[model samples]
Structure formats: C-alpha cells, structure tokens
Target: MQLTVFPAPTSPTANLDHGHDHGGCRTKALQTAEQLCNNRGVRLTPMRRQVLELIWESHRAIKAYDLLDRIKPTTGTAKPATVYRALDFLLEQGLIHKVESLNAFIGCSFSDHQHQQLLLTCIRCLEVEERPAAGVMEAIDRELEQAAFIIHHKAIEIHGICIRCAKHPPITATI
Candidate 1:
C-alpha cells in the first residue's frame, strides 16, 4: 500500500488546537475563520460571523429555528433559507457540523482542520459535550477492519443522563 502526501497551506490558524477554553476557543476560531476565508479568497461576512458566534455561545447543538430566533431581531426577521445558506457555508468550510439526530448544529471544536464531531448529549440537562474521540476512533477502525469497511469521518455519539442529573433529578422533568 502507498500513502499520499499533501502540501500544507501558509495559514497560521491551521495549527490551532481544540480544548475547553472559551477565551482561546473564540479567539482561535475567529482567527482560523479569517485565515480560511482569506486563503480561499472568500469573504467571511459580518452577519455570518454573528450567526456562528451565537452557535458557539451555546456549545450545544442548535436547531435552525433556534438560530433564526437568535438572528431575527438583529438580522431583521431572518428567513429560514437565509440562515440555512449561512450554515451551509460554515459547514462547507468545516467550521461547524450538523447533528443528524437533533437536526441541529454546533461549532466545530477543532481548530486547524475539520475534525470528526463526536457528541455526548445529556438526557436530563440537554447539555451537549464535544470532544475528540481518539480512543473510540481507534476502536472503530479495528471494528471496521473486522467487517472489511472503510470509515471516513468518525461519528460516535452517546446520549445519557449526566452526572449532575443522575445525582439530582429534576422536579419538572424538563429536557
């Protein structure tokens, strides 16, 4: 078997790392966005940045309707298609990922390149956790080998009650 070698671009943001630091996260994401758009000769419009920022603030999968709600007043009663187009651009740039199960999206926690999004949804608090599935990804590679399948982007999502919810049950049974 032979391996392919790809040349690297001259953008600095391509080396950013993904972690739980929001300060670093936002700064890095913005810088990365600029680098990516500039490298591709595309404009990352202000409105697009605003929409992406809202999604990042939540750190969870957000529905299109939800995004529309947040962007409406500022964007002057935004239409669904408009928001969808912005989302499409973001996804195309690998800046975000759509959660298939929830019909929602979250900011791509990875910085340098588009990384596989792995979500851990809390059944009780409805909080979504994003992390790199290094170990699980390796396991999937082995499993796929056993089945003679080639896996592309690794998506391993698990839904369950979080520790806080497990210890303290909600009174109203909210999601």
Candidate 2:
C-alpha cells in the first residue's frame, strides 16, 4: 500500500481547560443550543434538551445505557431508541460529542462554535476536558492532505491523569 501526506492549518487559538463555573457551562450550552437550533430551523425537542442536560450534569463522559437509566425515572419509561435518538440529535447539532473510545458522550466545550478539539480524559476522575489545539489540528490536516484523503469525522482522545488528579493521590475503589 502507498502512503500519502497532507498540508495542515494554523496556530493554537483557544484553550477549553477547566477552572470556572460548571453551571455556567451548562447554562451557556443550553442557551447556545436553543439559539443554534432556532437559527438552523431545527427544533430543540424536549428529549434532546433533557439528554443535553444530563450530559452536561458533569464533565465526565457517560454511556447510552447510563443515559437511559437516568432518564427513565424522569420520563416514566424512556426507551433505548428514544435516548439514542436524542443523543443522535444532540450530536448532529454539535451540542455534545461521542467519546468513541469510551463509547460515551460528553458535552462539547466548543458547541457554540464549529470545531473539533482534543478530548483529555482523566483516568482518576473520569472527567473529560476539551482542549482546542489548532496547531495539532493543523498538523492532522496537513497529513490528510498529503495522503490526498478526505476527512469524514475526527476525534483525538488522550487518557491520563488530569492536573487535579495528578496533584492528588489515585482514587481507590471502596470494595
């Protein structure tokens, strides 16, 4: 098989790191979702909104079944399909991101804007933080271009101890 290379883009412009009001993140995300859906002529259905809220309940990535379990109590009987559909809608609207490796979902930090960034998962805390490294994305673009390849969807996941976790000792299981 032959290899290919591509040309990349520019420098790093933003950092989605932690250290702010998490509630603010959720509020902004919901507001942004509302505005974007309205602007795009799409409806921010109740189910989708609920899913977005649950995902934004924390910075950690959560799985589909977990979402279903959480919603069933509130909805009185949430089907797998309903939760999945809501997740699909949120993902399509860029309100949330699917952590491919973990098969879980996390609210996107750059939801208001359009751009894919790095997902840093804290092994100890299980919190996933978004970091927009334009420099790194540029390099990926360059590599893809050199190979004459078209991009479909992309996500870079890095798993390790986050700053908070790194500062503290590892979390041990109760059992």
Candidate 3:
C-alpha cells in the first residue's frame, strides 16, 4: 500500500503554529460536541466537559496521566479509569484523536467532517497539527481489498522538527 506523507515546511515564514482563536475554538468545539452527543442520544457529562476543556487548552498532545493530574484539583477523587472512560467517549464521538507516536491525545480540529487524520507532530516542541487526508481512506480501502485485510482503527503521525524549533534551537547552559 502506498501512503503519501506531506513534509512540513522548514522556512521561517511557514506558519507552523496552528493558529486559531483559542477561546472561540474551545467554545465551538464544546458546542459541536454537545450537538453531536445530543443527536446521538448520548449525554455529555460534566466530567467529559472538563476533560474536553483541558484538552483544548493547547494544541499539543496530552497524555492521559497528565489529564488525570490536571483534573484532580476539581475532581478530588479522580482516577485513571475516570479519565480513560471520558477519553474513550470523546474518541468514539470523534471529538479527539490519539497520537499513536506520542501515546497522547489531541482535540480534533475538524470534528464535523469524517476523514482520515493526518497529524504533523513536532519532535522538538511536541506541537501537533491535524489535517484531513482526503482519498487516504479510499486508497487504504482499495489496498485492503486486494490483500483481504480488515481495518479497525487508523492514525497517521508524521514526526519532524517544527519551524520555530528549527529557526531557534534551545540554548544550552555552558560552563
């Protein structure tokens, strides 16, 4: 099976930062999640809302344990199972994606559309940018048909240094 990988630009002017109105994005995402749950006859619980809010706080991939830590203050008795359950719910509803390479989760920028996820992860800064890989699903389906393979889940992560990191490396302390 042939997979097309797009390289992130290394130029200084390349908009490596996935710029979005943070507050607006979060509001829209929460609204979308609520609508999706309502339409599917599922409840968007308070804990789920908290978890989604934490995930949308940044565009970077966040680990489950980290989420658990963050939610502890509010939900004093929060546990791993609780976070995992919320994460699973979000994933099922297409509200978030798991970054396989980083073993972390990121909020889906385009949750309304059904498409294969193409993630660009920065190795240095750990920033993740998601884009839709059109035709990728069809291509994979065609290949799977030829090989008689059944698919379960799919996540595509492309790792490379981001433009900011490339332009300015972290300064090391010299003795």
lDDT of 3 at 73: 91
| Winner by lDDT | 2
Task: List where candidate 3 sits over 4 angstroms from the true fold.
Answer: 1-20, 167-175
In candidate 1, position 145 carries an lDDT of 96
Q: Write the per-residue lDDT of candidate 2 for residues 42-157, one digit (tens) a residue.
A: 99988889889888877878899999988998989899999999999988888898999999999988887756889999866678889889899999999999999999988899
lDDT of 3 by residue, 88-129 (tens): 999988999999888899898888876457899987666788
Off by over 4 Å in 2: 1-20, 171-175
> Which candidate comes out best when scored by TM-score?
2
Is 1 or 3 the stronger prediction by TM-score? 3
Q: Candidates' TM-scores?
A: 0.73, 0.84, 0.80
Ranking by lDDT: 2, 3, 1
lDDT of 2: 0.81
Model 2 TM-score, 2 decimals: 0.84
Candidate 3 positional error at 116, Å: 2.8
Better of 2 and 3 by TM-score: 2
